[model samples]
Target: MTDRRGLLIILSSPSGAGKSTLSKRLLEWDPSLRFSVSATTRAPRPGEVDGKDYHFMAEEQFKHDVIEGQMLEHAHVFGNFYGSPMAPVQAAIEAGRDVLFDIDWQGAQQISNSVLRDFVLSVFVLPPSIAELRRRLESRGQDSAEVIAKRMQKSWDEISHWDGYDYVLVNDDLDQSFEKLRTIVTAERLRRAQQPGLLDHVRNLQKEFEEISA
Candidate 1:
């Protein structure tokens, strides 16, 4: 098959929704998909590697990059700033390698509305129920009760923007949701606009037909 332009696969969800898990599964399913390493002013959590997990930066540096228009999309979340760097994403897509983003609603909105909007595919994941969302958050054991409470409070705000995404999935079953996600990606990759090389193939076919007719 001829190569196609890469996609900016934006996956967003409220905290404790299955976006992160789905993103991980997606990358595992297709190793060619590059994960967009977002820059964040927040300190790295235990076992998180710099540049790999996130491009952890000081608040000053983060603001400087944003001012310089180096960030593709940025948002303030949890009292910290986070954004995707434009350079790597541009390079990856130009090379026909899809880039996966695990960001929040604000970031996804910005990217989807950007000049590169044509290449964007945004998906929003919703928890099956409020209780399940809270349970998932608590099961992680990564945050305190107060933090969980704050996330719960904010989840509704995130869910309200679900309609902005191209696809929305209630992540009640991990396997089923993943299959749907995979199908969406696979189909989007075959869209006519994505496959520039198809034109060349069509032209060649036309040439062959013309010679046969002659």
Candidate 2:
């Protein structure tokens, strides 16, 4: 079997954008793809598992890991510190199992510029329009009006970093956006598989063919 390195797939978007929904669908589409479980200083909500949902830690411990360089990517958002642990991502990549990250632009930037930058494939999702974004956020019925207003104010900050990503998708339609996302992952996996070892594999094949002809 040909050996191939795994991808650190990142999806970033504003609060009302469909990145999280798309990420969930992508995981369902490919069971082998591991979701990069992030470590957070926030307290877990009901029914949220510790390691499975997130690696819950104290603020001191989280900062210690960041200082020790144990976090692949870390960021402060909405008063909580979130980070991706380096060990699991590195291990998964070494074993050629793709890891998916549904993080914000800050975390994405950190990962994109890391030593593992070569393994990163970052994509940003954009809302079709500000009106549509507001509508979606309001429809969620989750956050209060003030919080929604704040998110809208910060939306442009996230959208402005769209150019930093390898691919940008306007998620007007969830199914279409998901199809494109799937295609991007499939192509990246194929590309990663065609490493320098492929040359050797081809040369061996040619040698075998010549031996049979002789």
Candidate 3:
């Protein structure tokens, strides 16, 4: 049996950069990959489900979890607390199941610096251009004009962290970007360090070869 460790795939992008769409396609491409559901202190919006979209938590509880070191990574954004729970991530990786995270740069930084940093593969998605990003945000029509402006204003802050990621992809075409994303995942999974079973497998082969030579 080939032993493998799960990868912590973190995908980040400013709103409307097609991160969400790429994430959906990645999940569809590989059902074995698990999504890392985040915990948030913000109220659930319409159509959002608890434990699905987020594990909606109270501010106090969220703070407590952070203090207790139960969060793999966390941040306060837009006045709300958001975090990835540590336990599930630890569990998934041990079971050799890749865990995917759709989070911001802050959370990605936190995870990249965590104890399990070796397992993380962080990717940053960028729009082809700021103007195109604005157009996509506007086309969504889910936010008010004021909110869209605010998002655009903060987009630079997000883009500034592009260098922090292991890989950065400009989402000019969704299909092309997704293909690259898949290739990254596939290559990461094949790393020698990830295949712990290879050591034993090689040892067995050596013994067989020695017997044949004798």
Q: Which candidate, 1 or 2, has the higher lDDT?
A: 1
lDDT of 1 by residue, 1-214 (tens): 3368899999999998898889989999999999999899998999999999899999998899888878889988879998999889988888888999988788899999887899999999999999999999999999999999999998999999999999999999999999999999999999887887899999999999999999
Residue 201, candidate 1: how far off, in angstroms?
Answer: 0.7
Measured by lDDT, the strongest candidate is 3
TM-score of each: 0.89, 0.88, 0.92
Model 2: per-residue Cα lDDT over 20-44, one tens digit each: 8999999999998999999999999
Question: Which stretches of model 1 miss by more than 4 angstroms?
Answer: 41-48, 57-69, 77-80
Per-model CA lDDT versus the true structure? 0.92, 0.91, 0.94
- Which runs of model 3 end up more than 4 angstroms from their true locations? 209-214
TM-score of 2: 0.88
lDDT of 3 by residue, 1-214 (tens): 4399899999999999999999999999999899999999999999999989899999999999999989999988899999999989888888888999998888999999998899999999999999999999999889999999999988899999999999999999999999999999999999987788799989999999999999
**CA lDDT for candidate 2:** 0.91
Error of 2 at 190 (Å): 1.4
Deviation (Å) of 60 in candidate 2: 4.4
